[model samples]
Structure formats: structure tokens, C-alpha cells
Target: MHNDLPIRKIIHVDMDAFYASVEQLDYPDLKGKPIAVGGSGARGVISAASYEARKFGVKSAMSGRLAEKLCPNLIFVKHRFERYKEISNKIRKIFLDYTDLVEPLSLDEAYLDVTKNKIGLPSATLIAQKIRDRIFSEVGLTASAGISINKFVAKIASDYNKPNGQKTVNPEDVLQFLEELDIRKFYGVGKVTAEKMYQKGIFSGKDLKSKSIEYLEDNFGKSGKQYYYIVRGIHNSEVRPNRIRKSLAAERTFSENLSSEIFMLDKLNQIAEEVSNRLNKSKVSGKTITLKIKYSDFTLQTRSKTLPFFINDKSIILENAKELLYQDSLKNSVRLLGISLSNLNTDKKLSEEPIDKEKKSVSVQLKFEF
Candidate 1:
């Protein structure tokens, strides 16, 4: 079944430094300091770091030891996913107040379909601003919002101005805004793919759109279609619902980037095992797998390959993940690492690569955040 096409009013909302910000809001003393949430122990990893810390080159998933070196005054605290999750629930409730079509990307971000709403606001831009205000007032956290006609543009607009900022990309402005966009900034353009694009001189949306779709497909494979429309301000993705998730993962952040054998491997094993348990509880099996890695400099990479057979075995999944992990050259100690399983038994695959407003069950992550 295809998602019904609608004249959607999509808004993407992302909290600023979710965990670290929340901690700061809770503890006034940590407000201006570079606070990295995790621990300072040798094995401790940062889950999130304040923007102040980011300036000092301290970031999420960095080792405490390394973070200390980068920012001598960096403060490390333990993660409280439960608190973040509770905050997420509050944010979800706020979105539902605007529309039932809310698609959550993480504990701190979501996409809202506000074509229809309880208050019935006439302007989506106003709606986006109102939501941002509500998040700050009620949740005590700053949020950025993007408002647009479709998901892709809206997602990009939200990040146009970050840290308690918001931008609205009217349909008329979509083309111009996209034209100057860096190909690397486009969602789903990971580190590896970005380097490849740069090598080909596909620096901005204009450069990317210059190449024929055929050439892009030949080079980027399945993701070429996404590259084609994103440059033109078109995205056929949907806002999926909260469902019985087939898989889940827990990643770690070191205070500093790490390339050591013991650090990354141990982290992967931890994430894979968590995913296994989530799958087991959901009683779902998947054939396709993905591994996400973020480097020290905040460049991200993902290596995903599909398997012919579906399995819920943890060992099998972890083993394959381990292989994918070591396959990449040790460029830097990874700051962030995560794993996911797709290709579900009851899978939804779109033949047409565009946003479908009819269905909210399945949607594309649309590769560009490589």
C-alpha cells in the first residue's frame, strides 16, 4: 500500500545538545562550561557534549582520556537515557498537540506533519515557531525547526540555523536554497560517499544536479535517486509511526576519537547485543544490516550490506558487524558507533522515490548523511 499523497506541512524539530543541554538546564553551574555527558574513566565514553565543549574539540562518543587532552577543563558525567527518554515523551506529546503525524528520528528530534491540527493554524511557519517556543517553555530546552512542503526540504531548513533557531523554506524558495547547498551537507551523504563526491567535484547541489541520474546511479548505486531529487528540493519520504521496532542499538561516545582495537570492538559488541535483545523482544527478524560510525572530526560513515537469509541470532549479527567494522581502514578512533537491522519480514519498499503522504508506516531514511 502506498502512502496517500497530501499537501503536507512538514516541520522538523531537533533539540540542541539534547543530553548535555538538558544537564545544563538542570544544573545551572554547568551552563557555560564544556560538559560532556558520560564518564571520565579510561573505559568511559561521552554520550553527548555541550556546544561549549564542542568548540574545544570535545564531542560525543569521545573517550574521557582524549577529551581531557582536548579540553583540559572538560567535565564528564554519566548518561541517563531514561531522563532523555522522558524528555522525548514530553516532546512527542507536544508534537501530537499539533498533529498525529510525528516521525521521531532520535530521542531529541522528530518530523511533524501539521497539515491538520487541533488548533488548526493557518500557517505552518507560525506552527513551527509555536512548537519551538513550546519545547523551550515546557521542556526547558532549545530547539531548531525547519518548515517546508516536503520532508527533505523541511529537514534541511531546520538545520539552517541551529541552537534555538528556526527557518521556513517556502515552496518558492526551495530551489534557490538547494542550489547553493553543499552536497556534503545533504542528508545521507556520509563521509565515504562525500569524499567520493568531492573527488568527482560534486561540491554543491548545482554541481550534483549537473550530472545525469544514470551517472549518479552507476556511481552511488541505490542512493543516486535520492541525490537527484534532494538537489532539486524533492523528497518522497514519509513520517513513519511508532511501531513494534524490529531492532534497537546503544552506541558509545568517547571523550576523544579512538582507533585502538579494544575500544571500538568492545563498543560494537555492546551495541550489537542490545540490538539483538530488542529484536528478540519484538520477535522480528531482518535480512539487511547497517553499521554507523562517526569519526573524531564529526565525519560519519556507514557500511550496510544485505543478507539473503533472515536471522535473529545475536552472534551472527555481531560477527557480521565486527567484520564490517574492521573492513574499513583505521582512519581515526570512532566517536560514535551504532547498528540497525532492516528488510523486515513484512517489509515496505517504495518503487517510486518520492514522499508519499498516504502511508505513515514506512519511509526512507534517504541516504545522504554518509
Candidate 2:
């Protein structure tokens, strides 16, 4: 089954604790110490945590108070978006030096297709190492990489050797590598999905492979087919270069939860303005306005309305956001309010052509050199 498709040399590169690492890189005193990038206030959530903090079970998205409880000496730092974007652009430049097929997942991670690279390097492993080396030398940061035949496998392999390391899964080793993988480690399987899989006795890729596709689809819906293909090492998703922006959003977490809709009006206006600014900056507009509300108890709610025409103006955005806010009464005291615009003009159908679509047929190399 694998021999019919064109073999790709894909690499997934992820930075090591990006936000916290950036903070440490700028502040010398923070090196080799537990640090988190985010607010230390009551409503604050940790954006990222350094390796030193991870030893104490501190991690991103954990509450500031809980993180402090876990790591008593955890140092909190504010986020510098412009600084991070500057460093991210530098890293992206390094990626472009090797291949034009770079797909940035975020500020700290990207997928690169170096199957036919500018550098004329046949070995993807060597290319990954070179990229990692350049990142460290040029940007003063460390990254880990995973090299494999496709994006899905490469992404999972990248995490195998993290924090300044790299791993490769050759074509021949792909099936067995996936079979031995814990179901929990499969890229798309979250805790909830893993729990559902466990209920079905799918503890490992091998177990998942035992179930018929019909059985899988019956139990897991659309994702079941995806799992069936993935476990068999058959993901053909391309490394899309120009991934479109699906939405534009901005939100604020307040120091104290606001109890009344009138009190939230000012915050909502500010959030709408931010969203409008971002939409204009990106040169895109959307018809859908979504109001995101996070209550003090951590529950989240979203109200959305799709308009007939796209808009990027602050007044229009604020007006629509206000309508959505009043559409539903307060369920609880709001700790966070957000405004988002979606159904953007930039949205388009991504090409589904195979990586080697121009070629009629291709065979995987026995040894998988790249």
C-alpha cells in the first residue's frame, strides 16, 4: 500500500518552551531557573513554562496560583508579542533558506517539505540538523525536529526528542513505529478521545489497528477513518505552504470579574476594536462576529452571528458584538470577554493534490535514505 505513493521528506520543527525561553534569553538572571510567561494575578493563566518549572509539574495553561503552588520559586514574566514575532520571523527566514514549502504552525513550530530542497541535500536528517543548528546559532534558541515521510508522522516524531534534539522515522520503520506508539501519543487523540479509545480497548496503535474500519467509524464518526489510515502509516496530507487565516480575534482577562452587562460593555468595545485592528492589519474582513465569554467559574460560552456583508470597521464590529452580548443574559460573572471575526474573505479551499501529483506513480525506497 505504501509503495504506490510518492515518498516525501517532511520535517516538523518545534521550539523549546517558546515564550518562557524568550524571556530567559532576554533576562540572563532567569536562565536555569523556573520561569513562566504570563500574569501572576488571580485570573492569570500560564502561557508557557520553562523546563526548570516543568520538573515541578508546572506547565502551560495551568493557573498562575496553581503553578505557584507547584513550583514555589516560579518567576512570572510578561509576554512581548513584537519581540517574539521578530524572533519567529528570523527562524522562518532560516527555514526559507532550505525550502520554500514551509508551513508555520505558530511562532515556535513549522512543517518543512525538503523532498526537493534548494540546498540539494538528499538527506532530510542532515537538513533538520542544519536547520536546528542555524536556529541555535542565529536566534539564540534551541529547537527539536522530527523527520518522516509525511506531515502527520513527522509531527509526532518531532516530540520524541524534544528540547534541542531530532528524530527520524524512515519509510520502512513507519508502520512498526506507529504500531508501537501509545494511543495517547497519536497526534489527534486528546485525553477525551484517548479515554473513549480506552473504553473500546484501543490502548495502542496495534489495538486500534485491530478494529475494522466500519467498527471504528461506527464508534468514532469521521475521525475513525482518519485513525484507520494513520495507524497504517497512510497519511497523505500535504505540507500546505500558504495556510489561510480562519479567524481574527482579541480578548482580555480582567483583574476582577465584572458582574453586569453594562460593566462588560466597555471591555467588549475594546476587544472589538482590537479584533477590527487585527482584521484591517491582515487586510481581511469577515461576516461572522462571535462573542466569547469565560465566566469566573471557568465555564466558556460563545455567541455568534453571521452578517450578509464582511466588515472590518471598529464601529460595525462593536455594534455586532454588543448585539451578541445582549442576545443572552449573563450566566455568571464574566472573567474574560473576547470578540472574534470569522468567515473571512481570505478563506479558500486548500488543494488536495498528492505531494507527487504530477507523477503517475512512485515507489518508496527500500532503505528510505531521506
Candidate 3:
């Protein structure tokens, strides 16, 4: 439903090459050099890469061998998930000082709602600048931010100004911004989808808007509505107060430990069914499901699979979980079993995938509670 209501202000903040930058900050000797974070072994993939390495065509998720081919002297480092989480928490604290409406997308990116704030700051633009400055000074790292009327535009804006920069869009300028945007630049149009769209004459936002809503839906299923709203800067979602734990999971801690391969698979299937029921009732679909197990000797293991699209079917979840559980040899007795799902799409509206704009810091953060 489109409404000509007063616009809201929103901001998105993302750390630049967050993991790689932290590694550089902590290691010191690796500064200003091409570096990738991951193992260099045949099976290793780059989790993150510094901007210097990106210049040589290195990218995250590329095979370590490919990364090395791009940048011959590229340094590869193991992941440090714990350290990254610690820094993420610190950044959250900083955002809290200004507002309480923070939504963390991941360790390196977050959305803040500054409609109301603790600092009583007059403008969101100043708030965004301060956040960036403080993050650099306090966390010893750079961050990029985007400010706009809603999450869709704000997130895209942040990406426009990478490496310690910010971009903002006035509510009134949304049409102009979106009109000039390439169709591929719209949020949910992945590479393959974009190619299809291009073939159908959707090279720009104007082309998208020219199509009938019915036409879009016929071709793209449900997400075509998203294109309609974001192209006009009409996102109305409030910054949630807290994040809903998109999925809930439990892992049993065995007292003695049972080492039967069949037993481990059974436990995982059970948990996946539980998770699937919970998701359906919550009106959610999940794209990723993970399996976890622990051995009698206290050794831990996990495997995960991400589907091409979200689903809340119990049979699907359990079946995928079972497949992941048996992929490798489960010779040892297991002490724990767990299941989790992510990449949630709960009747998603126009989210952070729209018009590019300027920078504004949020004074408040929203957290969603289930």
C-alpha cells in the first residue's frame, strides 16, 4: 500500500573490509599490502580481502588459489570469528550512546533508527558523521555509511561511498536517484536475475517502473512489489528495537556420549523438524540450515546448506539437515546435536536495497523481540 505520508530518516553503517581491516590493525606489519583472510590450501576460500588485494581482482569467496593468482604475494590469514564479534559489540555500544534502534545485519553491518535519540541530536546527518569518526578513532578502523528515508535507500547509499565515506538522499530526490540507477543495482536482482531482466529491457529503474505490477509478479513471483516501492522511496518499516533471533535452535550436551552414525543423523532430523514447525508458525522462510554435532572426546563439528530460496517446510529442513550430517564419516560417538536456520525472509517488504544517497548517523537503534 502506497501512502503519501511524511518520510522517515534511516541510516546504514558498514565496516570497510571489516575482518581484513581488523587483522591489519592487530598485526601492524600487514598494513597497506594485499591481503586475504582465509587459508591458502586447495580447499580454502577467501572470507575477506583488503582493498589493496581487491585492486588485483581478489575477492571474498574466491578460491585461495584464484586469489593468489590475482595477487601473487597476497597474504592469507585464518579467520578469527571471536575477535570480530568483540569489535562488533563495541561498535554496538557506540551506536547505543546515540540511539537504541540498532539492527545488526552481521558483525560488520547494521541499521540504526534515529527517529528519537539519547543525545537529542538535531539532525541525522551529523549523527552519521560522528559515528564514522568515532568508529575510526575508537575502533581504529574505517566505516562507510548511508542516510536516507528508509532502510532500502540507506543501505545502498552506504555502499556508494566506500572506505570512510557517506552518502545521503533527501526523500524528495528519491525518484531522480532511482530513475538513474541501473536495474542490476536494485537490491534483490542477483547476477542471473539481472541478466534475465536485461534481456527483457529492464536496464534501468525507469524500465522497471514502466512494467505493470502484474507483469513483474508474473515474471518474478513476489519480489516485484519490492521493486515498485523502493523505486519510489516508499519504505515504511520502523527500525525494530531488537533483532528477532530469525531462528531458534537447541543442541544436546550428552552426558556419556553415543557414537552411532545412525543415532547422530536421527537426532539432527528431529531438531530440524522442530525448527521447521517454529518457522512456519512465525510466518517465516529460511534459506540456510546448519547441522552441529560433538564427539565423545568433546570435539565439535558442524555442516550447513543454503537453499536457493527460503522455505519453512519441515520435511525440507530435516532432509537437508540429514544430508549435511552424513556428508563425511561420523565414526566417533557424538556428544551434542544442534540445528539452526538463517537468511530469513519473513514476508519481506522493501528493505535495504534501494536508492543511493548521502550519509547520516542514526541516533537510535531498533531491536526486534520475538
Q: Give one digit per residue, the lDDT tens place, for model 1 in 1-370.
A: 2233334578899899999998998889999999999857876767788999999888876767889999998988778889889989998999898888888888998988777777878688888888989988998899999888778888888888998898887655666777788877888998889999999989988899788778999999989966875676556566776643554555666656777756778778888888888888878788988888887766778888889998678899888888888786866767778888888775655434455322322222221110
How do these models rank on lDDT, best leading? 2, 1, 3
* TM accuracy, model 1: 0.78
lDDT of 1: 0.79
For this target, which candidate reaches the highest lDDT against the unseen true structure? 2
Report, for every candidate in turn, its global Cα lDDT versus the true structure: 0.79, 0.89, 0.78
What are the per-residue Cα lDDT tens digits for candidate 3 across 176-249?
78788898788778988899899899999888878776788888889876666667655666777566666656
**If candidate 2 were superposed on the true structure by all CA atoms, what would the RMSD be?**
3.3
Q: Each prediction's TM-score against the native?
A: 0.78, 0.89, 0.72
State model 2's lDDT. Answer: 0.89
**TM-score, predicted candidate 3 vs. hidden true structure:** 0.72
The TM-score-based order of candidates, best leading, equals 2, 1, 3
**Candidate 2 segments whose C-alpha is farther than 4 A from its true place:** 212-215, 305-309, 326-330, 354-367
